[model samples]
Target: MTEITLETRIAKSDEIVAGKIDDEFVMMSIDNGKYYLMNPTGSRIWALLDEPRTIGELCAVLTGEFKITAADCQKEVVEFIDQLAARQVVKVG
Candidate 1:
């Protein structure tokens, strides 16, 4: 398993087809044939992943936009990215 750190780079998978519906971001994984629905924060993260970015960079942007502390933002973003990677919705490098 690849360990994700602050320096880890991430981006949405090419095989993912996504769109926004109402307030949710929905996506389908071509490789896995699975669907995912992301909340507002997750949607924001997905949008940010339009290009590969370091985990620390993501936390920096998210901390400024959301009402969370740096520590909490990092923790949650890491966990969220872990889930996205497991689902093959995102790739980590």
Candidate 2:
């Protein structure tokens, strides 16, 4: 398992295909044939992963986009990314 830290760079896994449904996303993993759902916030994060980004970068972007506190943003983003990592739907380095 990858240790997720502020400097960890993350990217979308190539095995997954994602489709948008309004604000949410439905993702299918071609490698495992597993389906997953991402809420609006998760969908936004997925779209941002067009390139690898450090956790801090993602936090910075989210802080700028939402009214949440920096601490809260980091905490929640880490948890959400962990879920994605657990599913092998994202790559963390």
Candidate 3:
């Protein structure tokens, strides 16, 4: 199994807010004031964002849940993590 790396721990589930916009969903980190508009795949990724998970773990879960290839999940998940990290919504641990 691939090792996972979680940049930041989610402080509180309540600290995050989500809503659907058209066919997509938008999520925000209230504490950091960062906002992300996600498609279905991204939305699913956000749903599993938890304090105890890493990017790799999240990708693994995605593979199992979505029946996607590990390589594809890893690539997309890494990109998503990069964006979130850049926004300061997540930090390297």
Q: lDDT values of the candidates?
A: 0.92, 0.91, 0.65
Assess candidate 1 and give its lDDT. 0.92
lDDT of 1 by residue, 1-93 (tens): 589999999988999999998767999989878889999999999999988999999999999998999999999999999999988888998
- In terms of lDDT, the best-performing candidate is 1
**TM-score of every prediction relative to native:** 0.95, 0.95, 0.63
Measured by TM-score, the strongest candidate is 1
Evaluate model 2: give its lDDT: 0.91
What TM value does model 1 have? 0.95
lDDT (tens digit, per residue) of candidate 2 on 1-93? 877888999999999998999999999999999999888888889989989998899999999998999899888989989999999999989
Candidate 3 yields a Cα-based lDDT of 0.65
Candidate 3 TM-score over all chains jointly = 0.63
Per-residue C-alpha lDDT of model 3 across residues 1-93, encoded as one tens digit per residue: 123344433222465677877657787888878777888887666667645476667866888888779888777777776666656554544
lDDT ranking, high to low: 1, 2, 3
Clash count for candidate 2 is 0
